[model samples]
Every structure is written in C-alpha cells, then in structure tokens.
Target: MAERPVEADTEAAGIRDVQAQTRAWAALWRRSSPSSVVHVDATALSDGTGQDADDRRRSVRDALASAGAPARDRDLIDDILAEPTGAAGPCSRFLVVAEGEQLVNSVLSRPTVPGEIVAYTAVPDLLPLLLDRRGDALYLVVEAGREGGEIHVLRASQPSALRRTDVQGRADSLNKVQAGGWSHSRYQHHSEEIWKQNQTLLAAAVDGLVRELRPRFVVLAGDLRAVQLLSDEFSPGARAISSTVQTHVRAAGSSRGALDEHVAHTLGKLRKADESAAVDRLAAGDFENGAVGVGAVIHALQQGQVDTVLLDLEAIGPRTLFALAAGPWVASAPEEALGAPVLDSVPAAVALARAALVSDSRLMFVAPDRLPERAGVAAVLRWPTGPAVPGTPRWTQTP
Candidate 1:
C-alpha cells in the first residue's frame, strides 16, 4: 500500500527525483510478477527392506518426470542410481541437481517470474554459493530419503541477499537560463564542447563493457562531468536509468565495486523506510479520511457524496468496489479493470487531485485506518472526518 503515488521533486540543478513512484507502478499493474529464481533438487526414497531400492528410485524418477527436469539430468539420475554407492546399507540411493534448462522450465510452468538464481543442492552447503550468485528469489530444495518406500518434501527457504539493488549510472541533464549576453554565449559554447568530449569518452567505456559483460544494469561512478557524458550517450538505448550517486573512489572497476556496496546499502535503507512508511500509513486513519476506507467510501458513493475515489495500488479486487459509481479512482492493485484507464495507485489519486483544479469532484487516497472502518474489514480508523471536507461529509483530498 502507498500513502501517495508518483511524486517528482526537481532540484535547482534540474535533477528530477521520483520518490515512491515505482511503488504505485507495481501496484497498478494487472498481473502479479513472478519471482526471479526457483531452486529444486531430486532425491530417492529408501525402503527399510533394501529389496525395493530400485523400485523406490523408479518412483522418484516418475514424480520428477511429471515436474520439468532435463533429460540429461534425468539420464544422470538414472546413471547415478545404477552405479553402486559403497556406503549403502541394504538399499540403493541417488541424488540429482540441475539449474539451466530443467529448473527454468519448471519455474516457467508456475504463475510467477523469478528474478534471481534457482539452484538444486544436495546439502545446505550450497546456500552460501547460491546467495553469492545474485541470490534474490525463491529457493526450493527437495530432500528425499528412502524412508518406508515413499519420498517426502523436506525443507524450503527463500534466502535473500538482504541486499540486492539494480545499479545504474546517469549523467545527462537540461536547464533553462535567462542569461543571453556575450559572456554567457562564450561560457555556454565552452561548456558544451567540454561536456561533449567527456561524454564521448564515457560512452566508449560503457558501450565496450555492455558489449562484453552484458550486465543487466551498469553503475557509473566518476567525476560528475564524466557520469553525465555516459548518460547522454546511453539514454538513446534506454539501457539504464541514471541517478546522481555518491562513490568514495574514482577508478572504473573499483568504483563499480564500491557502487555495489553503496547501492545495496541504499536500497536496503529505502526498502526499510518504505515498509515503515506503509505500516504507519495503514495504521493512521488515512482510510477513513478519504475514499481509502472501503465501507465509508462505498457509502459515500451510494449517497453520491464521493465525487472521486482514491485507490491504493496494492489494494485487491476491482469487483470489491464495482458497486461504487464510475468516476476517476486511483488504482491500488496490479490488476486491470474490464474497461477503465487506470492510473498507477497513488499516482491515480494525485492526478485526480490535480484534475480537481477544474472538475467539481476531487480524488484522494484514504489512510489505512479508514480502510477497515469504511470497508467493514478489520482495520483501525485514525480519525473520523479525515476524508470528509472541513464542513461537509464529502472528501476533497486524499487522506
């Protein structure tokens, strides 16, 4: 959930800062995006009576065949089972692991898209390795032992880096100036030439690396001039989104390494702050204050008091609110309506407010508290009239 949607703050330097903008974008989407990676492993069940070892392996293979493991790994599993293990008690045993084709196919069958690596390891020892390998998604490791003739599901963990930031470098910018004298002209010409040269150098470096490494994103850390140069050259391809980031070092490789650390820390901080803010907003009576609360907002609509609606991007089910009149409301969930130009959640609310500059109705987001009270769901209302106009029951701004 978001308190407010897409907001941009332009600094004096002509730099645009979008805070909590993407949150709504994610929420306003129509479908759930899958995770980055999915890990899987295969093991055979053991029967206490050693006679059925081959049967147990066959059963395990059959189950895996239903899942999407690779033919090669499947062959490998068969080979391993056929080979004799010296430490065997009375039964036979085997384990299998695959990452490239088999794991991918298995995950694709599922509903979501995983973003990171999916590994299959026999033991947790690989946990550290998986985490090091851009570990950012869901991990499912299947541990099967020949326990009474049947295999079983063991343990699963979604090990996160606790720090994964998509790093990108940016540098281009524009500004409007009132100065138009000979001095300004000369300065502009000199500045433009210098900037162009720097851009050319950085562009070459970035383009070369991109061609070779093919990294998802690049984080450039150098002098401000050089950074901007790269931004201008790369902006055409939309290869990366650039931002003004601080780096203590200046060397290319070293700077990129330093940037990894900085970005990870920064993203962690941002995520934590976002979470805290969300919790607080939900706790506060924002829901009741605006059309945020499900019930009151709905009631307001039935009474024709709700001129507009402020929807949360993370909210669920458009069917829940179809009873309300058709007007501009912020979209909170990532689902699309059958027919509506849905704005990203919080952004939708803000846009409605801006549009109110002309229309009789206004739009705004409701606080979390009001969400439950108005909707009749289990939620707290921060205040009674937060969403209502000062002297009227109608809400003009998002709570």
Candidate 2:
C-alpha cells in the first residue's frame, strides 16, 4: 500500500474525521424519539456578507415555516446559519435536526453542494447526515512478524482507535547462523518450529477477536513469509474475510495514514461485494427470505419481519405512504389494514425508514439502476417470506 497524504491542519479538518463524526450521528439516531422532528440540509451560498449568505439558508427556513416549526426554532436556525462561525467559514454545508424549540442535533462539515436547501419534518432525515459515511466501521489490524505480532482493535463508537494487543511467542534461534554443522541444522529446525507455534497462537487470538467484535474485515501485514503463515492458520470462517496488505504498520517507515487507507479500502471492497451479492439474490428470484416492492416491504416492516431495508432514496423521492399513529406503525388504510388511527402521510422513504427504525432494522442505500424493481424498495428478512400468503408482503447490513 502507498502512503496517503495527511491534511495540512486546516480549520475544518477535525470535522472531516469520518469515524468520529459518523459515530456521533449513529448515537443520535439511536437516542432520538420519533416526533415532529425538523431536519434541515443547506449548502452555503456565499461568504457571510449580508444577502448572499441568506441565499443558502433561506429556502429551508421557508419550508420549515410552511411545515409550521415553532418560531423560536426557525429563528435559531437562521441565527446559526447567519453567524460567521456557524456554517460559512471552513464548512460548506449546514445540517440540523430539531424538535419544537430545542435543537436536537447539528452537524457542520466540509461537503460541497452548489445550491440546495432541504427541510423535512419526519423521522429526522439521517440519511443525508450519514450518506457520506459508507462502508466505514470497526476493524482489526494485524502486524505480523517471525517471533510475534501486534493487533490493533478499533472501536466503532470512539474517536478512532481503541486498544492494541501484542502476541509475542518464542523467539529462540529465530535468526539461526549457518555454522555449516549439525548445530546449525538443529538451530534452523528450532526456528521453524518456533515460527509455526507463533502463528498457531496468533491465529487463535485473531479467532477470538473476530468472534468478539465481528469486525468488518481483518488486515494482515508484515514479513511476507510470516504474514502468509498466519493467514494460512486462520479458521475457514476467519480466512474468508481476512486479507494481506503489502505495508506493515510496524515497518520502519510505515505511517498511520497508509494503514488507515488500506483498512478503508478493504472496507469499501467488502461493501461493494455485499451490495452485489444482495442484488444478485433479488435478481435471481430468490424471495424465500427476501421482499421486494413497496407493499410487501411495508407489510414485512409492520409485522417486524424485516432485517434490513435495501433502499434507493433518490428514486423514492417525495412519494408518500399512509401510516398509523400508534403501534403497528404502518398500514395502507385505517380499519381495513390496521386498527390504529391514521398517522399523517409520510414521505415514502421516511415511512420505510421509520418502520425499519422502530423494528431495529437497517436501511441500506443501493444504486438506483440496480433497484428498478419494487419502487426502489427491497429487503432481506429475518425469516423466509415464503409463498406471499396472498396478502402480507413480498417479504428484508451495517451500523
């Protein structure tokens, strides 16, 4: 792996810490209560010099006004976007989620947008806040050596890294001198045995790590021979997702940037592979534990059968769907579908997202072209959807 360039300590560079910022948003997602949540996404129009600044924050606030957010809440948004320290300097966009007058959460970051403002009152438009954080998650990094190695465990919720564990096995005679005699041959045999023993133990440690954290992937790097030995020792399950990198974190000239980039690249490949596999399942007419189309997906959500929602939010757009105010949150009609009173019609994406949220299911965004079926809605379910029951539904990854 090649070394990636580090930032030159720009003012907003801290905000670009993807791991930390994403965890912050994920925590908010779990803590927020469903209500009249106001979500706003705005692109900066220009420098904060009078009118040009308002061009960026205007439309969203007007939309908020139309949606009837409390006056105080509306003013708060304007004040933030108006301040030079708020959304203009070093940051290119402003995103916030509020409830009534109190602000719930806000994320100011460096994502460029030409001209756009969005204000939606629903299950907190988290998709936008989290969109840039794809295929990034906790993973383990292993630096192998003939004698032993080091393992780095990254935390999903923390700032960046969590802990490092060193597994040092026997190093006796690791570098045997060729004395051209029986003793030399004996020392060589001892070193080989030590290396194998080291790998065997290291593989066990890795197995425990994979079982414990279920990391997105494991990165192995170090001396070629030792790395291959350790890789070959992994159990079938662990070997499936473990990979080798040319650059080792412990190498003399290695920088953290290189290892970090490799981990990220490995994560991205895992995501692309997963997306392809899921799409294949859908395309192959494998609906046993799958659901496609809006109606089926919704029914599965209401029934708590959905495990993951494969969505194409851009395709779903502004379409709305009927939902219930109480339990069994989604329904097509009041008396006919569910006994609960009618909940306000919600954007189709949010409805599915809300249902998935309540049921602890995941929402995964897929490419629009790949999801031309089912109104851009599909799922991999907890159990086989099996035979469609004539009514229910066609019935469904990541943190």
Candidate 3:
C-alpha cells in the first residue's frame, strides 16, 4: 500500500521521545506466539465521515486485505476511526498501530504530516513513527515557591501530566520585618525557619519521585534562595540529574510556554550528556560489558545479555540476517541459528530488533555515524556473558 516515510518527522521531534515509544511497544511485542503477530501502522485520510473519508477507508481496507493482514486487526481501522477524536476535525494526522486482535495505540495530532497506511508486518515497524513524534518519554519538573512545590511528571506522547504531587510547606505570609520593632529578631528567625522547612519539604518530594521514576530529565525552578535550598536539601542522586531554572514557574500568571521552552532546552542538554557518556565509554574501549560489532551484538542477544542495543540503521538496515523458528533467535548464517528449510532471512536491523524486543531489551537509534566505523550494531549488556560457569542459565527463556 502507501509506504510512509520513516524519517518524515525527525526534525520536529527528538530521538529520545522516539526511543520511549520503541521501548513501550517492545514490552508488548514479545507476548505473541511465534509467527502469530503482525503490526498495523496506518494513517487515515481524513477525520470526517463524508464521501472522501469513505473512499479513503475503502482504499486502506483493500490494500490491507491484499497484503494478507489479519481481518481481526485490520478491522481496528474502523474502531480507531470511531474514536471521538476522529470527529474532532482539528487533527492533521491520525495514527493507529495494532497487533493481532489488540488495538495497541493511536495518536491524533495537528501537524501537517502526510497520510499513509501500512497493513502489517512480522516485526513492529517502528521506523515510520521514529521521526514523527513530537513527544518525550518521562521527565520531572518542580515548580517551587513559598507555598512549597508542584512535582509534575510528564510524558508528552500522552495527553496530560501522568502525575502531579504537591508538597505543601508553611506559607509564611511575611507582611513586613521592621528593624526598629521590638520583635524583629524573633520574627526574622521564625520566617527563616519557615523558608527552610518549605525548601526541605520540596526537596523530599522531588527525591521520592526521582527514585520512583528515574526520569530522563529533572528541572527545578523558582526563587533563587528557595531553589538553592531545595537543591541543597535534595538527595545526591536527585541533585545530580536535575537542572535549575531561574523562572518563577509556579508563580501566578507565569507562562507555561516559556517554561516548556526551558524544559526542552534541558532535554537537549541531557541528550548531549548521554551521547558524550556513551562516546567516552566506547572510545575508551569499554567493551568488557558491551558488544562492539554486529557479530558480537547478535551473540549477546542470543545469550540474552543485552540491556540496550545501539543501532546505526543507515549502516545495517539493508544488510541480511538469518532468523530461526525456535530459540537462538538470529544469526549471520542459517546454520548458526539452527538452520532449517523453513528458516527465513530478514533485514539485519529487523532481525536484531525483534530479538531485542522479545528479550525485553531496549533499542537506541543513534545518528548514522555516531557508532565506530563498521560497527553498525552494538549493545550494552545487562550482565556479563563471558566465561560463564557450567550449568548456568545464560539465555532468556524464549516463547
């Protein structure tokens, strides 16, 4: 049918957000029985019920049917169109991804993105949405003030704040501190104590969230003294990942747009930091718990040793890899993965991705040249795989 461009939205949305959805679906992609699942990625022509919409729906249906998409999942197109947002008339693009009988997820947005439909595939095709999302995974923003702080946990992919917990501190409505007054010293001390308690309370709340979510980014904003106190009171781990903003974010009449811009900037900084950390590790030859090339990476996946698979698709996507109908999921040669007349060969990127997903490992899509030359695929392991003791269970149990 109509092939959607995978890199269509890369410039608008960052890669971190794309990685979030990839992991999210990876968690769900492993549940199906072998050769039992197919993913449907489709975009509707219009959010309307007129003749044009009818023709578009028919076209999608015919294309999917021709491509052998399961009728059970193909019907989800109607269910997706039946959703309330379908009639909202404001969305510029509507996306639906389905697996077997499950309507996995749908996203409606107001960007001038192209409309296309992909019926189904053995491997969940994440490439199309990779560049098309403007959302981020998990992040935390603390808007601190005299009243305390609002700890907001956000995932832009979803509609609203996933969690917002407020830490109430003493609102010391300090009217005035007259130096000449008899009670001035006592009043000043009491006010200072209230401020201290407020910041301490805020820090405790933030620390709890940091430990709970281990968010991708954490930002603190408010009065300088209040921010400083909160930062100082925070747990070391929390303070290490958090950035501070001078804006009075929680203040009445504060601009949300401005705060969002600052948060986005922080996200960019964190991404760079992560890239640098990975670069330094790899550049220093830190392969003790990592794999550096395609063969080693495939072996790591076979052993169920990977935590995250780093891929330079530009270098590896078009290459070929063999897949098996049973355990030892993928290999460069059919014989290595238990060759059979029924064994299938698939794109290297797709085969490795499926292996990673089924093993509950993550995928990190890096810029093409970020990887060392010829090291198109690599992985950081969950644990060491070399020199295992006899009788040890080295592989993740495959379904």
Candidate 4:
C-alpha cells in the first residue's frame, strides 16, 4: 500500500475524528453488551481514646452505618484486609461482600484519605448480576507505570478442531521412469500405520491453526503422497484445500520461509487461470508491441475493456491506474504516477487498481512471468462494456 503523507492540518483533523469515532463506537459496544451500573463506598474512623483494637474497629463499623450502609443478615463478606497504604494512590485496605458467588459490595479505604472516600467501584460487585456475561474468553492485561498505563484486551477468535498423530516413520520410495531406466525416487513417506498417525496429528494441528488464523483457505504442500494425506486429513469449516506436490527443502518445524513460498505459488497459480483464459482469446496483431507498457493498459481501461487486471506483485510497472468517480475510463500515469504514491511493489500497485474493478473489492495476485506477451498485464475485456476484439498478434512473443 502507498504511504501518502498527510499535511499537518489534515493529520490533526484525522486524529480528532478518530478519537470521536472511537468514543462513539465504544458507547455502541457497551450498549450492545450486558452491563450494569454500580456504586461503592469506603470510610475510616478516628480511634482518639487510645482505645482497644475492638473499640477502634467498632468505630469503623459505626462510620459505615452512618453512611447508610448497614450490615445485612444474609450479607457475605468476600474479604477484608488492612496493610500499609500509600498517601495518594490505591490503598492496601479493602473489603468485599458477596451473595453466594455473586459480588454485592466492594470498598477500599486509603490510609492517606482517612475518613474521606478514596476510590471504589462496584462492577466487581454487579458483574454476577449482569446477564449474558462472557466468561474468561475475554481478559484485560495492563502494564502500569509513571507514564500512565497501557491496557490490552484479549479475546478468543473462534473455535476450531484439528487432528493428533500417534506415530511416524523414517522414509519410503516412489516408482519413476528415468530417461534410460526405471528407478525409485527416495523421499520421506509414511506407511498405512504412519499415515493414520499423521492424519490424527495433522487434523489436530489444522484445527488449532484454523481457530487462531481464521483463514478463508488452508494450503497443503509437500510430495504427492503428503498432498494426498492432507486431503484425507481435513479440518472442519475450512473453505478450500489446495495440494502442491513440491519438495519441502525447509524443515517442517521451520515452516515460515518454505510454507510462505508455497502459499504464494499456489495462490499465484490459482489467479493465473484467469490470465491464461484471456490469453487464449488473443488474435494475431493484437498487441502493438510485445511489451505491455503503461499507456496500453490505460487505453484499455478507458475503453471499458477490462474484466480482470493481471499483475505481478514483485515487479515494477511503468504505469499505474487511478479511478475517478465519474467514468468508466480511469486516469493512468507513470511510476508514482500523477503524484499518487506508489506501493512497495508493481504487483501491489496493480492489485490496488484491480481492487477497484472487483464487485466485492477483492483482487487476485499473479506472477508477471506467467502471461503471454499478447495478453501480458492486460485486463480481460468485459463483454459489451469493453473494447471489441482486436486483430491477430503482430509478432509471436513470450510473456
């Protein structure tokens, strides 16, 4: 994505708008959830007579009574404790009351604010009274310090399942016919017993991974048998399964580098289908040159001749498209075209332009090297809304 620099005025306004929006959203969210209002009170008393501890405690109880909060017969004290307290912060003295497991009252008395109320609240009391209370699925972790505090709320994404394996094996071989002889290709493989164990293990791993990532699709990569095993080891609710029979040069536990490459390749292949189909319809003399310069794409978009925009995310493209709200034809420019900030890669910029064309605002990524020259980086012309079919290619050229 392009990093467009904002002017000072715009940045300040944006900050204010974001703050207002956050408050509005928070209010809406609170109203959407089950919650209640609560109040809490705390008090301390003077023990001026050098009286016994019992007398001093009685004075405190009398103070509480004076506050119109008399002890009830069925009241349950959740806890009560006193300790050395700070002069201007939270106190080490507090009490809690509960009716069975439900909190009813929570009060804290600060030593520095003796006889005067410090800080107290009753959510600690009324949470049990609230309906539809989410369990420990949610939690707030806070780090407190002098510069203020930071609070992070963590919540479970969703529920999912996976398989657990009970066994594994060394390796196996696959039959192959070489140029001059028949031979066996050695690779890591599992027998029926090992396969069963893997199925369980994979299922369990997939289940947990799905819950955490909440991905729309899951990709499986490895040798042919491993791909087959992945198909047999499906987890619930995953939308699609794609198997790639590629050698895994990276370690299984070190899945980051190799697995990422596999995902990129698989997704690229899936997107390439559209480009390939478009290329098939190309006739002789279609492209002025083998190259798909920026101007050609802009002309195509202007003529409403694009159904899909095939782009390579890793390459630098000379031209970029900008959509204006008023018309079918879009404005085109060179790199950082028309002063619009360019994305990190050419494919990314093209993807941004393609997103404008998708009904649901989704774009497919592709490798630039995969397209035929005649249709290279071209948008598939949409019927009736696009340019008419052109003549045959002027020259046969590779993408």
Candidate 5:
C-alpha cells in the first residue's frame, strides 16, 4: 500500500463536523457486508532512511493482509501507505475501508504519539484517537503596530494565518521630535491616538474571530501592549476563554519548536485540571446528572442524557458490549436489550463511542488514575437523571 499525501488545510473543523463524519463512517460500516476495515497508525516521520520507509510500508501492507482486506482495495492501501512522512510536526493518519473502497482517509498532526494497527468487525474503533486529537485551545499570534499586523490562528497545533492587514498609524519618529517642546507633546498625543485606532481595528478582528471559532481557550502571544489592548476588546464570552503567553510574535516565529513546547505544556496542565474537576464532580455522589460505572453510563446514553462520556482507557481492554446499529444503547448482556434489535457485541469502547455519536455527545478517554470509580466508565449528563440509580445490581443480571 503506497501511502497518499493529504494536504493539511487551514479551515478549522468544529464539533458538528466531527459528529457528522462519525455518523457517515458509522453508516458506511453498517452497509458494507464483511466490512474489511483496516486501521494502521504509523509514524509520518520515518526514523531512519529510505529502507525504513520501505519497511514501514511493507509492514502496513502485511498488517492489512492479515486483517483480511480484499485485494480489490489495493489502490486504497497504496494511497494509505504512500502518505508523506517525515514532516516537522507530529502526524497521524487514518484510513477506513468499507464496501471494497477507501471511504475516509485523513492525515492528522499533533498528539504526536505512537501508532498501532487494529482490525475490527465493522468500523475501526477511532473514538479514542479522535478524542486525543481534539483541540483544547486556539492560539492567536498577533503582530503589534498601528500600521501592519498579522493574525495567525492555530487549532490542535496546526497553524494557519487567518488575517493580515496594514494598520496605518503615527510612526515612532513623530514622537521623538526634540526642541519642539509643545509640538513634541502634541505629536506624542497623535501617536497615542493612532495606537488607539489600531487597537480598535485589531479588537474588531479578534471579536469576529472569537465569535466564529468559539474555541475552549484563546491563547494570545505578541506585543504586550497589543495583547493587553486585544484582551480588553474581547467580549465577556471571549474574555472568559482568553489566556496569554509571554513570548513575542517574532520570537515565536523564529523558534517554533520552543513555542510549540510551551503550548503543549500549558494545554497539558489545562487538560489535567479539567479531568480532575470532572472526576471530582462525578465522585461527589451527584448521581443526578452524572454516572460512575459502565452500567450507569450505558443507561444515561440510552436516554440521550449524556453530554460527555468518560472512559478510563487502562481499565477497558478489548471487552465487548452488545448494541444495535441504529440506537444509542449498549448492554453487557443480551437480556438487557433495549427496543432496538441487537447488532453485535462490539469492542466496549467502540460500542460506547457509537452510542455517544448517535446521541451527539462528547467522548473523553481519561487516565485510569484520574477515575474515582474502578468500573472503567462514567458520564456527565446533559440533564439530571432524577431518582434513577445506576449500577443497581439488577441491571447487570443476565435475565
């Protein structure tokens, strides 16, 4: 399979887009008879030389063959194998095989982690990878000045310039006039006015971006004055999402490696803090709108009450959960089947993931240590579950 190179586009993808894609893949998986799905997670950056790349491709091909991929899908395999490797940043690729065709192929960056290969009955279990790749913040680098400035927007560590403009304003030399005492002061005032005007322009741009992107966090880096002024311009909503880094825009550009390291560190901290908070809330016995076990999470998901389903990845292995093709419910036993007919017992994680997607809920793969419950699964509800108690023992019965 020769890997195909996928161009990284600048357009940001929203949650709705992810949901829609998941639904589409789910549908494809359901329709393909004997869906020969093959998932290969390999490094886009090769460790050695050309031989290493060849070895990588051969390994992927061998894996695909072992996964029972039909020979008719060779072209698709080739495309997947040929994807450009050795990019400066982290890269991950996903290919979905179904209906004897390559339905979806995407090369992603960030979360530059190790890779693996998996062959599932129908759809590839992509939920964890997707969740891991999800962006937690939007980085906006703005150049300071009244005359010219550049705005670069980075989501999920992928950078793209969103806006650039020349902000005509008073020059510094105008404020440097000597011996023209009163005139110097007047020029200084003029320079201040120009700076204010520039700030207003930048503010308007930032406001529009904030409304459009609606990112979880807004990271601002550049001139201190510009950063402060832009921060002031943010709406209450934007202000709530904004954060700042000390690095200047030019310095960040010159040393992208350092900037990325800083961004990663900051985001890592934020993610850990968030996971802790969610775990705390779940453990608070506030079972009204949250669940602490697999059974409860399944029940909430069935009722479309789940807003975010959290899983302790370590606790969940290749366990299977019976679910239907068209419903957002999963059961540990056949006797617990809901209204929909049983499709198959999919990987527990995949079953939960499909259910979440069907209900338009988010999925979070949490570390085992962070989870308060040893049950391996939990969920945050969109609405309170009222008197409904989860994991009541009866729900786990075979009959």
Candidate 6:
C-alpha cells in the first residue's frame, strides 16, 4: 500500500475548511457500508534524522498489524505506511480506513500530544486532531532597526514569511562627533524623519497581513519599539487579539530557536485562557445560548444550534450513548433510539463529536479538572432554545 501525498490544497485548509471536512467524514460514516475503520497517528520531528522518519513509518505499520485488520485491508495499511514521514511540517499525519478502502490520508499541521492509533467500528476519532489544529492565532516576529525587520506570519505555529523590508533611519552614531550646533540638530531631524517613515511602512504591511489572515489572536515579538509600533498599526480587531512577547529577534541562526519558543509559549497561554474562559462561563450558569450534558448537547446539535462543543479530555470514561444510523439524533439509551438502526455501545464523546461535525460546529477539548462542575461535555450555542416543556421529549419515541 503506497500512500499518496495529500493534495496541496488540503494542506492549507483553514478552520472552516476543516469543519467542512469533518462534516463530510461524518456523512461518509453514516452512509458507507459497515467496515472496520483504522486511524493511525504518526509523528516525526520537523528536523529529525532520516532514521527517525524510518522508525515512525515502521511504527505505523506495526500498529496496523496489531490492529488485526483483515488481510484485504493490509493494502490500505501498507499505503498509509508508505507515506513519507517528516515530509510535513512539525505536525502529525493521519489515515482513515473503511470498507477495506483508504478514505483519508493527510498531514495535520497541528501538534498533537501523545499520538496513538486506533480502530473504530464507525467514524475515525477526529475531534481531538481538529481541535488541536484550529489555527486561530497569528504570530508576527519583527526586528527593531530603522531598517525593515523580518516579518513571519505563523498561523498556529506554522510559519510563512509575509514580508521583510529595510528600515529607513539610523540611530545616533556616537563614533563620529560632528559640529556641535546646527549640524547635530540637522542630523537629529533627519533621523527622526527616517524613523517616522519606517514606522509608517511597517504599520501598513502589518495592517494588510492582519486583515488578510483574520486570526483570532495576534502575537508580536522582536525589538520592543518595533513591536509597539507594529502593534499600533493593527486594525481594531487585530489589536483586540494582540499580545506582545519580550523575545527580541536577533540574527537568523541564533534567534530562531528563542523566538519560536516564545511564540509557542504565548500561543499556549492564549489557548489556556480561552479554555478557562469557556469553562468559567459554563460554571457560572452561562448557558444563555448553550447547553450542558450529553442529552442537551445532542438535542442542540440536532437543531444545528451549537457553535462550539466542549469536552473534558479526561471525562471520556465510558461508552454511554448510541447513535441512530443515518439519522440526526442520538439517545442516552439504546432503547430510546427507536425505529432507526442503532450504533450500539458507542462512546458518548465519539457520538457527540460526529454530531458536532455534522452540524459544522467547532469542537474544543479542555482538561478534565478544569471542566465546569465536572460536567464532562457541554456546548456553546449559536442561539438560545426555548425552555424544554415538561414530559415532552425532543425525539419521538416508539410506543
């Protein structure tokens, strides 16, 4: 089985695009003939040695064999194993199998912690990967000179250089003392004008990039003065997302590691803050437009009201929910899921994940300890639903 490279276009999928893909995957799971689904997670360092890449590939192969997939499906596994390791950016790779056919093979640019492989009866477990890669942050690192500095735009730690220009001014040179009066004053004025020009140019470039990227957060790094000037240039929305880092950009070879570390740390902090805010809101009875628990969340998802679904990573303790095949509803008990074919013994989280994806809602995972009131799963809705009428079930029950 030789795995082909993912299409270049899919490699650039943004948040909305990935949501669409998830929806499509859910639909496929619903409609496709029943077959074993294999998901493999292979990770290799961005700068790993060749041996590391080979080891990663072999590991994927070994995982597939351990899965005990049918002999017919060996080709699918082989194909996935053949995919070049370390070919992608500092991200992990995933492959999905169904009906003994390879369904999805792609590189995910998001960093997944503790990667693993699994075989599921229905849909692949994609919620965690999608949540991790949600590229909502844009990172910008610039240098501080009157000469233009390097500008790198990172959409979720994936870097792409946006621009680099020369700054126009030079700082006061103490090495050569010129005439004490008029000459010195003239030099100072000229330097100020150059600085002003550089600032304007830098701001314009940054403003354009922000508008185009439309990231949820902006991380700024490099020289302090340059960082400030660039921060001021951002649009109001970008400013709202902006955070500054103390890491100063130095020469290429020496500064890369430090700058990258700062950006990663800042992004991690922002992610945690966002997660905390969500959890706090839920804890405060902030379901003005949302719902908590598996039942309410599933009901909300069926109505396409959910905007984001939050799950506690540690709360996925047991399989307590079931899904109706080819239907838009889920039930707390297999008996409640009447008339439709039921996918029995499904993990509640997995079922909810599929529902969330089918509705094109975002999925977020939080540490189990941080979940509000120990609520294992919840959803932030797009709009408020009317109060549940007593004794009236959301789904029709067979008498």
Best by lDDT: 2
- Tens digit of per-residue lDDT, candidate 2, span 1-399: 112233334213332345445445544444334322333343444345667567656765787778766566677766655544443434434445455444343343534322234554434555544454444466778889988887776633223345567788988789977798898888888898899889888888888878876777788988778889899899887898788887766768776776667776776677788788777765454466777777778777878888778888766666777655555666655553467665567667756766666566766778776664435788777777557566554333111
Clashes, model 3: 0
lDDT for model 2 comes to 0.64
Q: Model 1: how far is 88 from its true place, Å? A: 33
Best by TM-score: 5
lDDT for residue 277 in candidate 4, whole number 0-100:
56
Q: For each candidate, what is the lDDT?
A: 0.34, 0.64, 0.62, 0.34, 0.61, 0.59
lDDT of 4 by residue, 1-399 (tens): 112344554334322322243343223222211122122222222123244533545544455445444254112221231222222434323333322232222223223221223112211112111111111122112211111122222222111111111223222322232434222222222144454454445545455545643443454444445445545655545325433434442234534465446544554554456446545443223533222434554555555555545444445344434432233323443332434332222232432343324221112234556555423354444533233346743433322
TM-score of 5: 0.78
Candidate 1 lands at a TM-score of: 0.27
lDDT of 3 by residue, 1-399 (tens): 011233424312322445555666655444333221222323345455567666766666677777676676557765555445432434433343454455344554434332244545444444434434422457888887766777777765545555667778777644448776668878877887788888898888788777877787788887677788788898989988888877886667877777778877776665666666665544443355567677878888888788877777777746778755555667888668754332457677767776776677766666677776556787878765555356753332221
All candidates: CA RMSD (Å): 20.2, 8.1, 9.3, 23.8, 5.8, 6.8
Stretches > 4 Å off in candidate 6: 1-11, 14-31, 34-73, 87-92, 97-103, 106-115, 118-120, 134-136, 157-180, 228-237, 250-253, 280-290, 383-399
- lDDT string, candidate 5, 1-399, tens digits: 011222334343432234555567456535425544444455542334467667766666666677776666654665666766444665566666665577656565534233454453554566535655553455555555444345555555344443333344444543334656887888777766666666777767666666875555666666676667767766888688667776675544355554566667767877788787776666554455577677778877777788888877667667789867556556777777766667777778778777776677776778776654455778877766565456662222111
Off by over 4 Å in 2: 1-122, 129-137, 155-159, 170-186, 255-262, 283-291, 303-307, 322-324, 331-346, 372-374, 380-399
The segments of candidate 5 whose C-alpha lies over 4 angstroms from its true place after superposition are 1-51, 110-115, 118-120, 146-148, 157-175, 178-180, 232-234, 251-262, 280-285, 338-344, 388-399
Q: Model 3, stretches more than 4 Å misplaced?
A: 1-52, 82-100, 108-117, 128-137, 156-159, 177-189, 283-296, 303-307, 333-335, 339-345, 380-399
- Model 4: lDDT of residue 165: 18
| Model 1 lDDT-worst window of ten | 142-151
Model 6, span 223-306: residue lDDT tens: 576667666666787677667767665545545566667667777787888887766655443355567777667777767788
Displacement of residue 97 (Cα, Å) in model 4 is 49
Error of 1 at 396 (Å): 28
lDDT head-to-head 1 vs 5, winner: 5
Per-residue lDDT value at 342 in model 4: 29
